[model samples]
Target chain A: MSDMSRPGVIHDLGYRHYDGLREGTPAIARTLFVTGLRHVYGLGRSGKSKVMPFLLLAMSVLPALIVVGVVVLTGLDSLPVSYADYTNQTQLLVSLFAAAQAPVLFSRDLRHRSIVLYLARPLSAPVFAVMRWLSLTVALWLFMAVPTLMLFIGAMLSGLDKSDQVTQLLKAVVLQTLLALLIAGITGLISSVSLRRGFAVVGSVMALIVLTGVVTAVQAIAAEQDADSASTTAGLFSPWSLYSGLANAWDAGIDTFVPVDGAWAVAYALVALLLAAACLLALVARFRKVGSR
Target chain B: MAVVTGERTGQAPVITTAGLTKHYGSVHALTDLTVDVGEGVTGLVGANGAGKSTLIKILLGLLEPTGGHARVLGHDIEHESQEIRRLVGYMPEHDCLPPDVSASDFVVHMARMSGLGASAARERSADVLRHVGLDEERYRPMGGYSTGMKQRAKLAQALAHDPRLVFLDEPTNGLDPAARNDMLRLVERIGSDFGIAVLVTSHLLGELEQVSDHVIVLDGGHLLRSSATGDFLQRTGSLLVEVVGTETERDRLGEALAQRGLVCRPRGAMVAIDPPPSELAQEGAAHDLIRDVAAELGLGLMRLQPDRGHLEDVFLDGAPRV
Candidate 1:
C-alpha cells in the first residue's frame, strides 16, 4: 500500500494507562448510587427534568416558611405547628415528589434499554437495584427533611424553648426519614416494573396517594360500624396511615391522620418495614432475570 | 499495553465455547455450539435470529446459558463472569445509550464502572471519543446524534476501559456505505493498532469479508462454519474472462473456449471457463489456450482472472440443508 497520496497526522490525546487500583463491587455500587441521585434531581438532565423535583421540593417547604413567618412576626413563645405534624401536612408534596422522581431513577433506564449497559458492568443486578432504591430514598428524605429542618431553625432563632423542641423535632425528622424510605421503596418498585414513565408516575401516585384516601375512608366506615379490629387493620393498606399510626402511638400529643391504638401500632411499624423489604425483593427479582427489555 | 495471556501460551485462543446452548421457553435461540476464536478481528456472521447476541451476553456473564459452558480470555463464563466482564468490553447489539447524557459523561461513567479512577476515566473517555472520530459533538446530548454518530459514541464507550478484548455487536448497523466503511476501518485499526482482540458481529456477510481475519458463520443457532478468512475465500477451479466487446464478444469467447474442450458459459458480459482437468493441464496452459483462441477469433481478451470464492458462498452452498 502506498502512503504518499494520503497525508496522515497523529495527535496525542493523552490516552494513558490506568495503573491505579480498580475498585470492586462497592465502588461500582457507589458510583451508580451517585449517578442515580444526580439523575433524580435532574442535575445532568435537561431543563424540563429540573422542573418537577424542584417544584415539588418548594411546595413541600412553602407551608413551613409561612409558619415560621407567622411565628416570627407574632413572637409566639411556642411554635404553632408541631414537628411531626409538619410531614403529615406536606405528605402530598412528598408523595408527588416520589411519584415523579422514582420514574426518573428506575423507569428511564428500562424505557431507554440502558439497563443492559449498567448490568454489563462489575455490579450485579441486586446491587444495582439496591443502589437505585437507596438513592431515591435519600432524595425523598431530603425533600421531606428540608421543610422540617426549616421549621426547627425558625423555632430556634425565634428564641423558643430549645431543649424540648429540639428533642421532639429530631424524633419527627427521624420519623420523616423512615416515611421517606417507605415511600421510595414502594414507588421505586412500581417504577421498575412499569417501563413507561407516564404509567409509572400514574401508578406510583395512585399507589401512594389515592390508595391512602380509599384506605382511610374504609377505616372510617369500619369504625362507624363499631368494627374496631377491621378499622385498625384497614390502616395497614395505606403507608401514610401506618406512618401516622406509629407516630401518634409513640406520642399522644402528635396529631395523626389515622388514629391507631394498642398493639396495632406495633403491627403498623412492622408492616411498614415489611412492605419496604418486599418492594426491594421485588426489584432485585426483576433485575435478576438477566434480560430486561 | 500488556495482553493478559492466561493459561494458554502459544497461539492461544481468545474465546472457547463447547456445546453452548440457550432456549427461551419453546424457542431455542441457540443450539449446541462449539468453537474457538483466536486473537485479531473475528467476524460473527449470522442472520438476525441466529443467537449472536445471546452468545455474547453469555460470554459476558450477563445472561446464563441453558446448557454447556464457555470461556473468554481464559475465564470461565459461568463462574468467573465478573472477571470476564472486567476484562472484556462490550458494545451491545441494540440502542442502549441514555438520551439525556452527553457522550463524554456517559463514556466516563462507563469507564468508571469498569474500575478506572476519576482522572483516568475522563482522559480515557476523551481519547476514545477522539479515536472514534468524534469531535466537539461529543459534548452534546446523544439524543440528537445521527445513527452513525451514536454508533461511534457506543464504540468510544466500549473502548474507554482499554480492555484486552471487546465484543462489538453490529457496530456498523444502520450506517450508510461511506460510514460503514469508516466504521469497519476503525474496527480493523482497533484490532491491529491497539492490539486488542475484537469479536464483531454483523448480518451482512459481505461487509465482514474485508476487515475480518477469521469468520464464523451461524445458522439457526448452529455453527455452520468457522475458518480463516482466506479459507472461506479460496479460489474455485474456474476463471472469469471478460472481452473488449459486449455480449457478442463474450459469447464468441465462450463458444470458442467450449470448442477447445473447456467448459465455458457466458456470465453477463464475461465467460466463466472451468479449469482444465489435471490429466490435460499444465502451468499457464489454460491461459495460453484462451489467448490463442481469442487471437484466432479476433477477439480482445480484457480480463482473465480466477473465480474467487466469497463468504456468502458458505451460506449459499449450505442454504439447501438449512
Candidate 2:
C-alpha cells in the first residue's frame, strides 16, 4: 500500500548475496520452534487446518464463559466449579487438542521427508528434535492457559474472594503446565513413531483418554476394596492419571478416590518429569535415525 | 592431490575428500573416494544406488562415514561439519515441501533456519522465489503444485540462505524434457551468475555434460572417473567423415583411404579414420588424401570433424563395476 507497493513495480530482483548476520544454532532453533508452534494452531497453514484447533478451543472456552455468565447473573455465593477443577472437567477437550495437533508438529515432517530440509542446515538432529518437542509442549500449555486465564478473569470480575481464587488459579496453572508437558511428551513420542496421521491420532487418544479411563476404573475398584496403595499405584501408567494424581497430592481441589501421599506423592512428580525426559530422549534418537536415512 | 584430474576448475577448491569410505554393515556405500572438487558447477554422476546421497549426507554431517575424512570450503566435514553446513546449501533429491504451507512461507522459514534475521529472510525468500521463476504461484499452498513448480520451490529454499556452495541432488529427477532443460539452465546460472560453487548430481551423463565444468562418475561405490567435462568429450584422435551418398560410396571412400596406408573403418554413414602415422602426418596430407578420394569416388562430403568421445564411453570402456 505504500509508494513502492505500486502494482507495476517489478518483483524480479534476481539473486542478491546475503552478507548479513547469519545467526548461530540458537536462532535456528528459535525459528524452527516458532514455525512449529504456528503450524500446531494452523496459524500459518491452510484455512482447513485452522478449523479443528479453533473449534476445539471454542468448545473449551464456551463452558467457562457460560459459567462466568451464570455466576455474574445469579449472584452465587461461590462459583460452583473450583478454579483447579475446571481443567479437570474439560479433560476431554484438552486431550483432544493434544491428540489432534501433535502429529501436525511431529509426524508430518518425518512422513513427508521434510525433515531433510531442516537437518540440512547448521542444526543437528538432536537440536531439531528438542525444538519440536519444546514447541508442542508450549503449544499444549497455551491451549490450557487461555481458558484458565478466562476463568481467572471471570472470577475476578465476579468479585470472588481475591486471595482464594488467585491461589487456586495459581495451582491450576501449575497443574496444567505439568500436565501439558507430560501429555506433549507422550503424544509427541507416539506421533513421531506412528508417521501416519490417523495412526498417530489414534495412538495418542488411546494413551491419553482410553488408558486414563482404564486406570480410573482400576483406581475406583481398588479404593472400594479399601486398598489405598493399589489405587494410588494405578495412576502411574498414563499422563492424565499422573496429572490427576499430582493434583490430588498438591491439594489442587480435584477429588480422587485415593489420596496420593507420602512416598507416592513424591513418586508422581518424579515420574512425570522422568517420563517427559524419556520421551524427549526417544524423540531425539528417532530424529537422528531419520536424519541418517 | 594425487587424485587431480587433467583440467583444474580454475577456482579455489571448494570440497576435498581423502580416503573417504562409508559402509552400512557389509554394504559399502562409498569406498576410498579421494577427490579434490574446485569451485564451479561439478556434476556428481551416478546411477540410483551409487552412493551419491550417502556422500552428500556424510559431507553435510548428517551421516558419519566408516573411515577417512573430508572437507567442505576448508572446514573438515567430520569435525567442522556445522561450519560446512552453515556455508553450504543442500537441495535433497526427495520431496521436502510440506503440503499445507505456501512456498514463500516455507522458504522464509528455511532462510531463518540458516540463521538469517526475519526481515532479511523475507527479503531473500522473495528474491529467491522470483529467481527460481515462481511468481504468484509461490503464495499458494504447494499441495497442488506441478512437479516443475515443486522442484522450483525446493530450489528456491536452497538458495534462500545465499550459500557459498550448494549440493543439489538430482535436481531434474521428475521433470519432463522441457522442465529438465529449464532446471539445468537455472543450475548453470546459479553457478555462473550467482558465483556460487555448485555440486549437482544426475544419472544422465549426457545432460550433465552440457552444464558441468567437471564431472565425477561413481559406479558401485567406486570412483569411476573424475575429469573436466571437455576431457570426457575430447576428440579421440580419429576423424569422422560423413558422406552424402549411399553405403556403397562410403565404403568406396574407406577403401581409398585404406589403400593410401591410412587406417580407416566405416562407422554407420561415415568413415572413421585414425590419426595417420608421423610419416604420413605431413601438413594437409591426410586432409588432401580425404578430399581427393571423395572427389574421385563421386561422393559429396556432408560433414568432417574429429570423433569426440561421450561420457557414456567411460562406462562402456571400463565397465568393471556392476
The candidate maximizing DockQ is 2
User: In model 2, what are the clashing residue pairs, if there are any?
Assistant: none
DockQ of 2: 0.81
TM-score of chain A of 1: 0.91
Q: Give a tens-digit lDDT track for model 1, residues B1-322.
A: 1122222347879898988999989888888888888888999999999889888988988877899889899999889888888888889878988888899999999999888888889988988998899999999999999999999998988888888899999999999999999999999988887888999999999989999888888888888888888888888979999989878778888888887799988878889887787854887899888999999999888899999899989988866223
- For B1-322, candidate 2 gives per-residue lDDT tens digits of 2495647746568888998999999899999999878878999998989989999999999999999989899999878888988898899998988887889989998899999999999999989998899999998989999999999999999999999999999999999999999999999999999999999999999889999999999998888989989989988878889888789888988988899889998889999999887877877778888888889888898888878999999899977564
* Model 2 stretches astray by more than 4 angstroms: A1-14, A74-77, B9-11, B319-322
- lDDT tens per residue, model 1, A77-154: 988878887888777888888998998888877778778877777887888889989999999888878888899889
Q: Which candidate wins on TM-score?
A: 2
Clashing pairs in 1: none
Chain A superposition TM-score, candidate 2? 0.94
Where does candidate 1 stray beyond 4 Å? A1-20, A69-77, A158-163, A256-259, A290-293, B1-9, B319-322
